[model samples]
Target: MKTKESKKKRTEIQAVDLFCGVGGLTHGLILGGVKVVAGVDLDSICRFPYEANNAAAFIEQDVKTLSGKTVRKLFSERGLKLLAGCAPCQPFSTYSRGGRKSGINEDWELVASFGRLVREVQPDLVTMENVPQVEQHPVFQEFLSDLHGYHVSWSVVECSSIGVPQTRKRLVLFASKFGPEGLSISESNRRKVTVKDAIAHLRPVVAGQADKKDPLHIAPRLSDLNMKRIKASRPGGTWRDWHPSMRAACHRKVSGDTYPSVYGRMEWNQPGPTMTTQCFGYGNGRFGHPEQDRAITLREAAMLQTFPVGYRFLKKDEKAKFSLLGRLIGNAVPVRLGEVIAETLKSHVAFYASAEKRECA
Candidate 1:
């Protein structure tokens, strides 16, 4: 049951967030006027932040146990329930797809299982997001097949096109049971937000000094040698510019040409390279600050993900660890992209609601 405040706040639409990692999608739905009542995730690390920002209860439950009864009670309504989730994508990601397919990665099975929950819960609408590579995976194919009765549509949308400052592409899908017509989202054609627009205001702080206004935005500690490596690498330059002594052994060989993303720096005017889990490392991808000495801070990574600057992911009294929070922010969906998904689905729901009422009368 929802608390009195929650019941009033969420009078618009109700949502149950599955696999809610730090509540990125949930935040987007909230911004779109949906009330997210509960979020389920196996990671305890997500609870603090997920609950702090959204008026939702964070349940640390493995989603395999999820069912309609549990979901219905949490939502406290039978009207147009929304089921949203992003199954862990590490297994179906391009990185894993490029590797040998010998052993089974459990995360691969979770995608289809997410489909099972959708069928069982029978929510009025569904939305999912994953790496672009997932669209080609066999498990995703099966999930689509399972959603056969719904009005379904999907595409590999560029995150930057939707106002995310990072150049990340994700496969987004929407399914609704309200009609026979297929659903499609209008693509945003606006100019992409650049790296400078995302992180330009902060005062320069070398590797260790935390920003006084936002400590969570502090960059990671750098080694003395790596510090020199970053200084040698100009914006948009690679290790090729480094003196012979500074080159890593792998980069010195002909085969090293394959690993071009290493020791790169961002172009101030363009969208940033995708913010991966290791984006806090200056040597990883084009993650170096365009002008600052250190790598982009945790706050900057989240901003590039299109998360608001004041978005809080940790308790005020917590240690405010940089590397740990960087990992979380880097991996989250750009909240704006999530909002796009919600808005698209909302239009579809409105159309169906009108149709259903006409049919009943």
Candidate 2:
């Protein structure tokens, strides 16, 4: 009764966000005028932020165990149904593919699970985002098989193309039952925002300090060794800038100079390196502040990921933990990118609906 009444208030186009990490994509869809009824993710920690910020229900169920009938119950029986997800990307990430680390057995099958549900539910529109390498995997091929009767399109999207001030690339796939022309978003023509443009205005806080007004603006404590490395580090320069004695053993090897960004600083003019689960650590990637002695704060990282300022990751003054927030903000689909995706979907739906109306008239 209450559920039926609640469904009445939403727009004709409704969506469910699977693997909805901390509501990044859900928030973007809502901002773009799509009525997201609920978000589904396995992480229990995702519940609060996904619900608090998005005004949607967060169902903490692993997609593997989630049933299509369960998901179907959440959507209205009337309107255009949409399914959106960013499957656990670690299995196909460059970092993982380079033999650094790969996800568990379950993660390998998540894409298949996503495909299974799509086969069962048959939504009007389906969208997915993942590391570009996923498109090469047999599982991704199998996932596309699930879209047999629909129009499918995919592209490896540069995050900067969507105005996100970060160096990250993702493969976006769109499938629609609407016929030959499928939904696909082009580059947002908006001027790209730079590192300086994104975070230069925040008050500078040194290593191991948190601002009184913004707890998330805290930077991690640097080690004596890394402290020296950061001091000698120049913006856009690699470990090559460091004195030979100061360079890490890994960098000294034949392959040492290969990953120079390991201890590098972000240039003010360019987008920052891709945010990862450890983005707050100075030694991780090119995360050091351009001129500051410490690494960029969680706030700066979030900003680079295009999460709006004052975006709440914790309860009022609940305190911020670097590891936790790093994973949440790092894994989030940049809010801006999500917005671009949603806006594109809205335009696609409108165009088709109008064309159909004219045909009927």
Candidate 3:
């Protein structure tokens, strides 16, 4: 039953993750059977977590300044190579749509810089993930044009459809020197995961308190008035349900009526809202807990992103700092989504290998 091509395809595939924030993608890819040798990011805070969790080297250099030769040298002794770059998505995020700058920002240039490295290294495979709106930018167009040597497949992926317990959408691109037709990720077709499915089991904590057993379960202190407001807030309801005295001045205005997601509690049966850099704050989006009078904790947010409960974001002796931990958890690519990408790539490689063997015979 063993085909020579299938056996050949079993050779190890090694990868380097660019812009690897806290190693979410790296961890998922490893679960999908890729040997991730290293990760690159500019944030010094990520160094400990990235290395500690994945057992991979972390490079603190900015990708814009990173040379392809330097990256290639890192993979000199590896087998098949993969280059994964998930550039920062702030420039194209839906939250900033109305006031979005017309021209390129430093973040946009990082996409181009990632493309330049692809051209330089010409690795066996390449993958990228970012906000879906990025597809509209000329920078994305330029990056695609640079991939003439590889076959590319891209689509806007709905995170919930792929087992993430959040309603987040992102653009994902897969390119390979192998060929075009073999790269699409099949739809997961499973039941969508819900908020209760992800985090309802955690011990409850009140406003401004931490679960004594888990430091990361700490909530930010709330003002007395804010505490009253949260107690009145209903799951899936907006400020419209609040008493006249409790409503913020802006919510009483016509312009603020449309922003209903703010100061709302999540519905346990549905997927949570997209986690953002400020997700730990109760005032940000629908981050308030369905029943508790506080926002979700750092550990709860991480679990929603599909990170393992044991995933170490802070050192053993390090105290959990809200802002830093929030940024890391909120900005992460969900680990389940990364696993999907890796599985797709593995299938693509196997398909091509089988085809090549048939042609030779």
Candidate 4:
């Protein structure tokens, strides 16, 4: 089903990341040797970090309003053009089920729009990463059907299987105008990274306090009652482990018993829980520190997402607001997983280029 254009060999690869939140995918691709020409997103706040960290132009335009012609203009004429689109995954996330209503129709429409650009631009390669629930949506099926001229490969990727220190699972797709024989990312053989491996060396700060040295290491202030609860809480233990007087009124109700992952501390030797948008809040999921009487800091959350320790999420003189930085870190694709995808695409291109050379001889 690959197009005839796929048969040609390329000397390099160039890409543009769509819905690129904070440049996690762009950084990974750059580390894998791809020249990312531009990153497109609607959020203006992302401009500073995306442009500051990566050498690509940040196009602050909605993907729905973007045209294939506009995207093609950004590509270098000499390389294999690639498109990477990771539309907002809330529309199909497991957390969005049961009338949670985190997504809108526009979100679903973005996937179809991504497919439209692929058909119109006819890029040599494409990659998309989203929640696994997206696989069950009609938009996903429609997206797959649109790939008639491209070789496509997709699967649910376990983040821990690829050396990420979290248990996040995502649906990843890789497609090429070349044949589909070699598109899957192989599992990494490296030992699983643990929470201790990530944040153990940071200078310690207590609840309601920031490390004097690192601005991002500030923890949220806990209420007196909440502070007492955390004191009684053990790693991997929930509110159920607390003394009877410390139990919340909701926990006494039968319905609240099922939400045991809340108000729990992370285990040091194990990977941390999935970092969500409210990861900076102690009451959100199991976000409490294993030993400390506070939730992990913004910097700790970013590190758990596999960002480099010194990666700057804010500019000089900018204040580190918890909600702003938390959303940025939580919504980002883990940098390590992005690297895995980039490496897979690089190898796939190499295999086909070698095959084409043998045919020419």
Give the per-residue lDDT digits (tens) of candidate 3, residues 1-361: 6565556544457899998979989998988888888999878788888998996899998788999999998884546789996888574332223244533476688789889999999989999988898899899999998788899999999889988999998888999998886687666778899999999999999777888878888789889878888899999999778898998888889998888989889999999999987889988889999998998889889988999888888777678888778888888889988888888898888787678668877
TM-score of 3: 0.93
lDDT of each: 0.77, 0.84, 0.85, 0.85
Give the local distance difference test score of model 2: 0.84
Candidates ranked, most accurate by lDDT first: 4, 3, 2, 1
Position 241, candidate 3: lDDT: 82
What are the clash counts of all predictions, listed in order? 0, 0, 0, 0
Q: On residues 110-151, what C-alpha lDDT tens digit does candidate 4 reach at each position? A: 788889889888999999998898899899999998787788
Q: How far in Å is the alpha carbon of 199 misplaced in model 1?
A: 1.0
What's the CA error at residue 65 for candidate 3, in Å? 0.8
Which model, 2 or 3, shows the larger lDDT? 3
Off by over 4 Å in 3: 1-11, 76-78, 91-104
For candidate 4, the clash count comes to 0
Q: Please give the lDDT score for candidate 1.
A: 0.77
Write model 1 residue lDDT over 1-361, tens digit each, in one string.
Answer: 3355543432245788888878888888888767788988877788888888889999987787777678878866534688888877684332233334523456677787788888788887788988788887899888898787888888888888877787888888888777645366566788878988888876777787677777777888888887888888888888888898988899989999987768777888899999887788887778888877788888788888877888888677565676567667766777888787777776766666556557766
